[model samples]
Target: TSNAEKELPDAFLRRCVFHFIEFPEKDLMARIVRVHHPDLDQKLLDQTLQAFYSLRDIDGLRKRPSTSELIDWIAVLRRAGIASVELEAGMPFLGALLKREQDLLVFAEA
Candidate 1:
């Protein structure tokens, strides 16, 4: 009985985490570019490249695309620029992630 009651808090917390992950379901065709602050590190950009290579080495399916994810992906896609629907869209794309402007700030650092 002690174990059973203790498990509820853990179970509830886990579900809360999962819900956060899936919330604000992405708009798959949205195009985006990330305008990092001018002082933003080249290293962060470099790290983003490393992450992209890892994804290409792993993805085995046609997948839904979100705006920020697409911007990262264009690097991996490289000179084969024709591969990006987001690039074809060509405006400075940021996804409609916000129900309000407040939503855009999640990615921004103070």
Candidate 2:
């Protein structure tokens, strides 16, 4: 199941690169969503994200999601915008991959 989830994203990125899309950094948030709600709908995530931005200022920093610290990820991605769908996925996935303060840098690096 986990592998399937991972591959869905891997395939999307490979396709993006093939098509010459400029994948952005926002995709990182998807990682956080996968951790809490692996089956979370991309559409609902989109809605949650829209709600996120609609509630805040364009240049303002979000206070973070109320559901979980992990959900703070949704904020990170929203701030980055939609061009980075792949990076959105990476946020939660990599967040899980690197929990330590030291590894945090690695997660960002990845």
Candidate 3:
């Protein structure tokens, strides 16, 4: 649950049971996305997931977006009627996925 494991005290760490969860692969993520957005267009979902994963790959990101953020970003896109074609040019509603200013700036520069 913590991003800063080094900051925790030894006593606190000793009492905790840590389990690392790997980020979902594309197929698993697509299935997860469908659960929240069953009727979403296939092309849009594919493109969105691609962009999301690409964002996560960016180096020096202070806070990479999570599944929750991806869901939120897709929600905004759906509400805004964003088409898959638009995503090819640039990601819309990026703020939903990237909360940190530094992260956003890094993405922009990339």
* Worst lDDT 10-window in candidate 1: 23-32
lDDT of 2 by residue, 23-87 (tens): 22235555656676565557758655454333232232223222354365554544555334454
* Model 3: ten consecutive residues of lowest lDDT: 1-10
**Candidate number with the higher TM-score (1 or 3):** 3
Badly placed stretches (over 4 Å) of model 1 are 1-37, 64-67, 70-110
Cα miss at 22, model 3 (Å)?
Answer: 0.9
Give residue 22's lDDT in candidate 3 (0 to 100). Answer: 89
* lDDT, candidates in the order shown: 0.35, 0.45, 0.90
> Candidate 3 lDDT, tens digit per residue, 1-110?
77542588789889999899988999999999999999999999999999999999999898889999999999999899888998899988889999989888899898
Top lDDT model: 3
Model 3 clash count equals 0
Q: For model 1, how does the per-residue alpha-carbon lDDT over 3-52 read when each residue is reduced to its tens digit?
A: 32245577656655432233122222221123422332344334433433
2 or 3, which is superior by lDDT?
3
